[model samples]
Target: MFQFHVAPSGDDSWPGSAERPFATLDRARAAAREAGGDAVVHLKGGVHTLARPLELTGADSGITFQAYGYGTPEQEEPVISGGRVITGWQERDGVWVAEVGELDSRQLYVDGRRAERAALPGLPGEVRVTATGYVTGGGEPLGWRSPADVEFVFRGVYPWTEARCGVAGVSGDGDETVITMAQPAFGWAGELYNSTWEGQSSSGPGLPTRIENDAAFLAEPGTFVLDRSRPGRHVLMYLPRPGEHPSRTRVVAPVLERLVSVAGARDVSFRGLVFAEATWLRPSAAEGFLHYHGTGYYEGGGVETAVIGEGASVTYPAASVTIPACVTFDATENVAIEGCRFTRLGASGLGVTGGAGLAVRRCAFDTLSGAGVEVSGSRATSIEDNRVHHVGLEFSGAPGISVSGTRDCVVAHNEVAHVPHCGIVVGSGQGARILRNLVADTMEVLADGGGVYLSGPQGDSPDNQALVQGNVIKDTHTPYNFGLYTDYGASWVTVEGNVVLRADNTAVLVVGPPLENVVYRGNFWDQDPLGHDNPPSGVTYGGNVTYKDERELNAATAGIQSEAGPRR
Candidate 1:
């Protein structure tokens, strides 16, 4: 059993002993490779920032990264980051300005609280300028010293669409801040009915309620402005929380795309490491979102439903440093990641593909823009006893933990809540055991979604092959959001022994066609378990229990939250 040590202030030339640790993860992994067979690397408690991804291979097998001198079993381990901490702030003209590098980031953190990008003061006026932004209802004399640093963030433009674009230039046409989009809006929005590339004025008054990331919107504390007009770069922040100035306040931004990644390896593990502050490109044509059009339903008797719209929906353009995964595995086998944290990430936390006995247990995934932990085409994978929340921050379509096109995978004993979309899903393929999990506060902002959604099958597995059992799903307060949904020709699925409480729609929705022999039994719901638009065949639902009082059922799963995380 060989052991390598890594510290924040250590040197790469050091022997990786406890007294003289290695500086980078690469050095420790090299030492582990030299030692071979069941070696462990202990990371000292602090931030270990990565300039590039720590790419691992089959040689990286039988290695582990564990945190040392930090955290109890109940506390978080040391942080390994793809982010650079920003310091050296000066009060310039009432705003705190610090020079960051020439890097692009949509997410920013101030004193541990997520800061909103600068925004417009409020709603805009009736008139808009060509492809530029709207003439605001109150666009007085605004000073946009750096238009390149300014971005127009349009929230809730439609059900699933949110728009953000940098300003090419700002023209004050009389009382209007004519915000010209650097990338034309029509090119981004596409040719909708009459909606031009220049955002067509909605038939109604307007769609956007919050337009953010401009200088005028930086009135409140915890709001920030990034100015890229100067020689290097500058981030202007408005600090609101008490006892926080430049010296006292700490800011961080993503520097690398991925902190840790492994591919084509076997028998490795990542233990007790905090993966944080990784960046992702905001969804673009380069990294486009697929419009599936309910494409999971299969029509052919021979061809099965593909796992489209299943895992990470954004097809990020191919680049090592662009598509960041906090910790990723591909085509590996017999690996484990235990008691780790996946937080403040711009993209998916853990992405495992085509691996067997891959265990991601007792981990926490928080404040992520993409899916929490997504596994695809992996056999006998185990994702158990983890806590996931506040994920899908930028994209609302991805699930918290997406088990797609995998056989005999176990997604059990996890607590997933406060996510924008599905909590746990078996998108395609089969033989999954979804058991003893707690799902709540989900499906927050999408047009149509559920807490636990099952789509059509890949030709390999039948509907009854997966088991949905012993989960507590509740408090999904969005329109068309259910506790459970078997959508788009989901066939022969078994749903049993789950507690479904307080969903916006029916507790279970089995919609569309080709549905056959779906059995539902011993499940508890506060409302009607089935959707109003029920499918046309082969559903045997009996032995189900309904309750008008949801508190009783909530009491049944009472110890779930405390078991998963500290009280928020």
Candidate 2:
């Protein structure tokens, strides 16, 4: 174990004790590299400003920079902050400007103040300008000598013309200042400390409402305006929303896209940080806070976070977190994610494209904007002992768990609730097991749904062949009468030794041409068959206790032993 303390002011040295601490993360990183072994860089309790994203590259071992007072069983405090800062400003014409290279640009001025693009004696009405300009009010033009007392303001940036404008409207306590965008610009909108827009119009009227009062808007690269009709508090545009794609998709959020880009980077772990208020070009299927590309183990310690898109707002009727449907996994193997919470996620909470031997345990997935977990094109994955609740967006075909194109997986011991569709579904997976799980209050709405649905392959050979056993399903409501359903060449699927209670329809409904076999035996059902439509051929039924009503099963002469299995 190596101890290195990082602060704003100190020298870089090895053997860094409490008295002799190291400053800057770069020097500590160098010491860790020099040791050529597992390393631990303990960051002291203070903000360590970073100029760029910290990239760790080396052998997959103990390369950890942890907060000194974080992730203890009794008490934990972890804080790590990164990103660059704007240093100097340039006054081009009348607008005060600062440029952080070609990557980002900013204008320091109030709303509604307009600056001249060309060298002019006074503010001109219209100028043939190559760059967009800003107007600063409330005295003289910033960096100029004039006296104009005004408060209400508006600011606009025309990135296409390389100019920005600021305007002043009214003056008084009632004269609230606002900054509107005449043209959409790149980079984060600064803190709108105490200003508001009464009602402004944009190409997308819903766009401004989607930005939270304190939220940051990374204006879509185009042309738009900020209007200050009725002054209100100004909003900031810093972090991107979850699932928002950049104008140039190539310049997507770097940290969010890192996992999908770096394939086969092993033994990576991210702990005690917030990855909130950022967007990814595509939804990531990696298992931890820091996504992984290759076969690696990821463990998070009590981190509460969210990943949402720019378009998603508090008023919008969609989940903020959006994931891309397609992800490429480069032959990575053996992944595990534990002790984290995923909330307000769009599409699905956890998605997997291709991998081997995956395990997710003891995690809570709540307020899912889409399905809880969607797995495709993977092998030997286990989703065990996780609490999945309040999933399914409005007017969406969502489930607690949906699987497709995988083999030999297990969906076991999970508690699923408040889903509008099936609780657990094996969409097109083969030789999987759906066992010993408690499913309650599933299938909230929609006509055709089930507690557990198994759809086989469209062509020859069933897609799902598994054991649905020893599970307690209750309060399943659907217009259709099938609690456990299978269709589309789904054969050799057995529904046995389970307890079903308060089902609106049939306890077990098997739909087929009887291609292979589906056995329903040794289970307790609240309702019995009115008449036998399909006999025991490919579908067999025996040793089951039925109740005409709740009293019969508990009566003395019911003659139905609940523990009997497969009565001859």
Q: Which candidate's TM-score is highest?
A: 1
Worst 10 residues of 2 by lDDT: 155-164
Candidate 2: residue 367 Cα off by (Å): 1.4
The number of clashing residue pairs in each candidate reads 7, 52
Each prediction's TM-score versus the true structure: 0.83, 0.49
Whole-model lDDT per candidate: 0.67, 0.44
Model 1 / residue 187 / CA error / Å: 1.9
Which digits, one per residue and each the tens of the lDDT, describe model 1 over residues 282-371? 432222232221111111122112222323122111211122356789898888888888998887888887868889878899988778
lDDT of 2 by residue, 375-459 (tens): 7767888878777787654213467777777787888778777776678777666777777667777777543556777776412
Candidate 1, superposed: residue stretches over 4 Å from native: 69-76, 121-123, 128-143, 153-167, 172-178, 191-207, 282-324, 458-464, 508-510, 531-535, 551-568
Question: What TM value does model 2 have?
Answer: 0.49
lDDT of 1: 0.67
User: Runs in model 2 with CA error above 4 Å?
Assistant: 1-72, 75-330, 457-465, 507-515, 529-533, 550-568
